[model samples]
Target: MVKTKVITIASVSGGGKTAVTEELRKRLSTSEALYFDEYDFEGAPDDLVKWVEEGPDYNQWNLEPLKADLESFLEREEPPAYIIIDYPFSYKNDKLKDFIDLSIYIATPLDIAMARRILREHLKKTSIEINDELDYYLKFGRVAYLEMENAIKLNSDFIVAGTLKVIDIVDAILNKIETL
Candidate 1:
């Protein structure tokens, strides 16, 4: 039996991973794209906002749960021919890394991400206070960017831009998968 192919689009908070993943979902006729943010939380008292604020480590507190849920989902459904996950995958999760067939890292410059965050805060009418939560995310973003660079060094595919063109990245990954 052929194993299902899983493609993950991962990056920092404002790296356009969702945009790329959504475009990939639309472009691929046979694939089902899953957004980790939309996954059910199963009555967890704290919401994502709380999780982002109080989590011990980014992966242990936030990303690990998502990875576990995703792994369970994959096992239960066994999914469509191709599965694309739109989430930031921390390098700490080796099990999650092992499950993916291809990982695409989307990277934008730190300055660009900061600008995007400011714009997002303004649009949402939220305070621009640099609290622990903001600091944690900022640090995570920096670490994620560095990890993505290492992933590229390890031959993972990547797209770097303030504004990414998803179609091009999706097409390239699809073509590579077809040839493999």
Candidate 2:
């Protein structure tokens, strides 16, 4: 049985990773694509909320559970199973080296990401809560950005310009995967 192809879109908070991942997922959903947000681990939502209300120390805890889930997903035997993962892979873990088939790093200017975050905050119903979250993200996002840069330089298959259209980025990634 052919192993499933896994595509990871990684970047700092406010980067277009989620948007690109969502668009790719929508396009490939008919092909039975499995969408996974690394942050969707047990207690992640609560941690995220806490981080928003308080600060970034919350994420400093272990991420082994999330890594385990990713490893399991990658090891599954299923052909034509496209998994789009939205997460920031910074650490030099064995799992990171093993599971990722194609890693696309979205490179955007910090100001641009901030602007996008502001827009996203405006679109949210809970503006206060979202703003708090955004604030925390904005502060710690820089560190994530640096880590992401290292990760991308070390493992990425491609570094897409963040200004490109989502469709174009998706197409580029799909094309690369097809060749492999």
Candidate 3:
């Protein structure tokens, strides 16, 4: 049986975690990729400002569904050699920490991430809606993003520049994994 290593890629919103995870999966023949956005996690904060003000606890979000799915994937007769996840919490969440063999944090600049997010996710929205969202981001969301990044980066085994090309990022991650 191949020993599967769980590798998690963490980054702020629009920091290319998903892109890197997908590209890495394609390059690694015996790998599976999981995305956090695919699951509706319980205890996820609805108000970022409030959450941060309350002294954010990354473990507050229950990741049981993700954990369950991960276990099921690993139970396959021919389990993957690597399990890559585009997760936000890195090893900060107690429930998922033990399963992580390697934690990677993408250090993306706030401005760059915000630009990417606005261009990618808000194109369909009206101008007023986009403005309102940006206003909110400026007011409260930035704090949450910064806090999350700091926490994850502190615990991560590796840090990749989010400004790198997707292929380059994947190369870096693969190289890091090889060293491990």
Q: Model 2, range 1-180, lDDT digits (tens) per residue?
A: 556666777766677888888888877743323334534444443444445445334245455666666566665564346777775653234445466677778877766777786776567558677777667766654555555555453566777777777788778777776776
lDDT of 1 by residue, 47-77 (tens): 4444444532333433456666566656765
TM-scores of the models, in the order given: 0.63, 0.65, 0.96
TM-score-better candidate, 1 vs 3: 3
Worst 10 residues of 3 by lDDT: 144-153
Local distance difference test, each candidate: 0.61, 0.63, 0.90
Deviating ranges (above 4 Å) for candidate 1 = 39-78, 124-163
Worst 10 residues of 1 by lDDT: 53-62
Give me the displacement of residue 166 in model 2, in angstroms. Answer: 1.0
RMSD each, Å: 5.7, 5.3, 1.1
Task: Give the C-alpha lDDT of model 1.
Answer: 0.61
